[model samples]
Target: MVAKKREWRSGRRSVATKLVQMTRHLVVCEGTETEPRYFGGMKDALGPANGRKIAVVVRGSGRHTLDLFEHAEELCRIAPDPYNHVWLIFDKDDFPSNEFDLVERKCGEVSSSSCTFHALYSNPCFEIWPLLHLRYTTAPMDASSCQKGLVDALKREFNVEYRKNMDGLFSLVDSRRQDAISNVDKLDKHHKSIGNDRPSTMNPSTRVGDIFEELGPYLDKGD
Candidate 1:
């Protein structure tokens, strides 16, 4: 008599599961050290209660913001179908306000054919300063002073020496990046809670929540 074959089960979790248990890669530009700090945590923050799992990657510094478009070009040349969803974030600086059209055009030329691309711009620099300001300060804080206050908060929290004014904020985020990576390892084993609240893809409003909300339809839409 012929024997029946047994089905295989994923008793053991994989590395990607630890990241966000994602089927599609969520590519993000203007990589933030603070915002979307960890893959799992960001997933929790941006994920809806019933939404599918999402994975995130911060491409690099926005100083080379346009380079990300070229990177997308290379990606399309290779697999082409690997990334079904892509989100590009950048700061509005160096270029004039009227130059947004040009930036969007460059991104479109590379990203239009292969994946779903959404370009988000933060004035001056990252929206993190504004987000943090909104969280801590009452009135709107300038990017420069917001940077100072954030650095002070982190320094006080970590008990570290204070650094420069505007640039100090970067250090605060830099410190958190490690914590995020470490948390990834832990999340591999357990469903850990991230940030100050529960994970909800429905509401992407926090600091720079608009970007999260804007990207929501694309991230959660059925294709």
Candidate 2:
């Protein structure tokens, strides 16, 4: 949203203007529990924004693919304040390739000067994100296979059980946040090299780290 025009009485008008320029982000996820819980923990960990420069809101839609994209659009449409960025987070899963790819295409169509929509997807499932923290693998996997991989990785690496709705899941793997981001980038390049540019065809890959990359500078350091 554009800042209101103001007549400043104090010498700190520039500082006040900076506060009004705060960027707001809306993250809409497909899963009702797991995705929301993981991202919610990240929001908490980010704490308060410095000088109110950034604000993040995370919501779970209990929807998938194109439906999740529509839900995100509606949320932004009805939001009291306009969001500077809207992120649609979902899984490639077994959704038809055409439908899976449509969301990313629609993101471009719906974007404008005021807000930009991004389709950040995980191939197979969201569990791939957590699994990346422990180790990186380019092997293609389906939903069940990805979940099994995560379970094995968690048990082997941290001696912890992987639960679908586990609390503090973010904190459990926060230490390796950078590693996960790096691995995701590597996986992305691997897919590109193999001519697998479509989101639906990029197995065992995720763009979830893109959100973290954008928000890294605004994260609260006190935590």
Error of 1 at 188 (Å): 39
- Among these predictions, the greatest TM-score belongs to 2
Clashing pairs in 2: none
**lDDT tens per residue, model 1, 191-215:** 2343313211101112233334434
lDDT of 2 by residue, 93-177 (tens): 8889899889989999999998999998889899999999989999998999899999999999889998898888898998898
Query: Could you estimate the TM-score for every candidate?
Result: 0.44, 0.88
Q: Which portions of model 1 miss their true places by more than 4 Å?
A: 1-23, 31-40, 43-53, 61-63, 79-81, 95-101, 108-114, 127-143, 149-211, 214-223
Predictions: Cα RMSD each: 13.2, 6.3
Candidate 1 matches the true fold with a TM-score of 0.44
Worst 10 residues of 1 by lDDT: 198-207
**CA lDDT of 23 in candidate 1?**
38
